[model samples]
Target: MVDADQTFVIVGGGLAGAKAAEALRAEGFTGRVILICDERDHPYARPALSKGYLLGKEERESVFVHEPAWYARNDIELHLGQTVVAIDRAAKSVRYGDDGTVVHYDKLLLATGAEPRRLDIPGTGLAGVHHLRRLAHAERLKGMLTALGRDNGHLVIAGAGWIGLEVAAAAREYGAEVTVVEPAESPLHGVLGPELGNVYAELHREHGVRFHFGARLTEIVGQDGMVLAARTDDGEEHPAHDVLAAIGAAPRTSLAEAAGLEIADRAHGGGIAVDERLRTSDPDIHAAGDVASFPHALFGTRLRVEHWANALNGGPAAARAMLGKEVLYDRVPYFFSDQYDVGMEYSGWAPPGSYDQVVLRGDAGKRQFIAFWLKEGRVLAGMNVNVWDVTGPIQDLIRRGTPVDTEALADPRVPLGELAGRD
Candidate 1:
């Protein structure tokens, strides 16, 4: 039933791709495994790029998913710095690199990941304009932050999302001036909503970070090919020596699109549409991580998560599914953020309009609390700030899908386990 002569080709060199290769081997697959990555660097986790590494608290080597020698030892054919230009689904092969070399595969996996969205405004091409996505980008930004810190330069950031806010915290730690321009009224409004978003706003404000809310960046004013200021649509100019665009990232779907794969629409988080088994429209091909939008039986909707944990768990699950193992990926969506002195972990999906009420546990003023978004009386999502070791219970509350009492949920004396219908 198993073919040793078969070859499994994986596209994309991010965390998901690398872990899939590891899982294939762990699953006792003896077939040839080829992993192609456009980046020359080894497969690395992305969280560090915006957090520890950017803050100079993590070593460069700590970001890699595996040691450099691990691939060779595992017999994985790693094609670093190579781009797969085209996929031939009918031929079961891919055209890669400038020479157009083709590699055939019996099975394929796409973990192509995403790229930072670019600013269409003027002066984006100028010096001192930066984005933090790749390790190289973090390295460059780290150097820039050091220079800005040393010279007391003002760094203007566009977007108040996770990346923008994390970078702002790192900039403040480096003693650089930071001004964040966000279209939303509060930081993380799209995710945490206004109530908790205001908490982050206050946290950053306490650290001397300036926020210009309810405005979009109109242009990055520059002179002599270097940033000078950022102008907002509200006709206000914010002085700056550098600009960081943390607007967000868009899924890289060109290869899948060209191959005629069924891609999910924007309303469902645009990505290659995959089934519960991570199988795409083409049965021979599969997708995982940020690029694959798959149905969540628990959430009752198709979701595409761009966080590190998805890649950490999704790859192995996809690999097992490829190995003819029964797979049902219903893991609760999870993500965490660290800004200034506050750290938080969020579980489940509770976007605006999806929840009826937000209940709080512990102290909000002290930045130590758990915020729960409830639909009717059922727990939909929970975020713990400056709180530790409650991710398990929070996820349990969401997965159980049972109504929880707000009074018991808010009472600090009540054990979280007792509230989640657990013994």
Candidate 2:
């Protein structure tokens, strides 16, 4: 049990770690809170990196979770630009980088989030190639995009995931040619499935973006340490003033592994294994955010979510659990993305191929719709794309596990809340 004299150590400086600390203080714990962050910047919203911030539509200062003064005022020791090299479980302490300063903890929370998966292709180390994860990367990419815009240059994105697509939209907004290469038939096919993925594919196409589907990136061609072009398996050469590798993200779990926490073995769900309350195998250690995989009562399987909402909600839940308070953490996973004029919000788990079919309430042609994933006439998950003010009803349906009439669900005239019996 946490007491006033104990020290609480949080290993990540992202939204999750920051929220956990805030929750502790709000709960009147009065314990020592030490937050260790590898980034030089203060805790900030990472979602903005591929959105408004990357497009220069938002200021760098605006993305921070707290102003520098907020930390000092709250009496939270904020360690910036310092890496936690190792966690000594027996010693109940964590070692820092190089200097090896050890910080002992009564309770430890590992919120180390995920990182972008890198490609092993040739020329990947060339200049002008980038990955979007940190503020530093975003600053460099912004400058590159600006230069490309002036030269009317082109960008070859290596993947068609959310980050890649968002960056493509931003690059195009700057008036640069964007070509997206994907091995799948459509962008986001793995997440939203082909029908909805086609919607995004056509949206990009209509905005003058090029696509090379079912192709493999052979090499990134460069000269004088600068990227000039990229070649795919189809032997097609695409201009590449800059390249973004947003293939996917892998959970940062090295510390969890080294500290003897139970690691998940799933192919796509590898991370530290935690219970429903976010407690790890070690009683004194807790894991949350992208680095932790916990069993979802709704999904009936271990799930590791990498999105803003999971980190936002899970942080406080983990904090409560750390304090020996009751925490089930049953909140349905939710996330949103902005690409071009399309704003999409998705809730709940559809678990690839688990849903029988997708029912649409609006027009995909018009880029305004609500797509519901149904399993045996029951709504399992739902997504609203460019459709306003209905997430509450959509999420309620999935949460309550209530069956609905397909005919009424596909009709836009019927209020979503009425169908969920909220009316």
Top of the candidates by TM-score: 1
Which regions of candidate 1 are displaced past 4 Å?
Answer: none
Q: How many clashes in each structure?
A: 0, 0
- Tens-digit lDDT track of model 1 for 84-164: 999999999999988999999988999999999999998899988999889999999999999889999999999999999
- What would you estimate as the lDDT of candidate 2? 0.90
Output the number of the lDDT-best candidate. 1
User: After aligning candidate 2 to the native by TM-score, how far in Å is the CA of 12 from where it should be?
Assistant: 0.9
Give each model a TM-score.
0.99, 0.98
lDDT of 2 by residue, 353-408 (tens): 88888899998899889999998888988999999788899988987776799999
Write down the worst ten-residue block by lDDT for model 1: 1-10
Please report, in order, the local distance difference test score of every candidate based on alpha carbons.
0.93, 0.90
Each candidate: RMSD: 0.8, 1.1
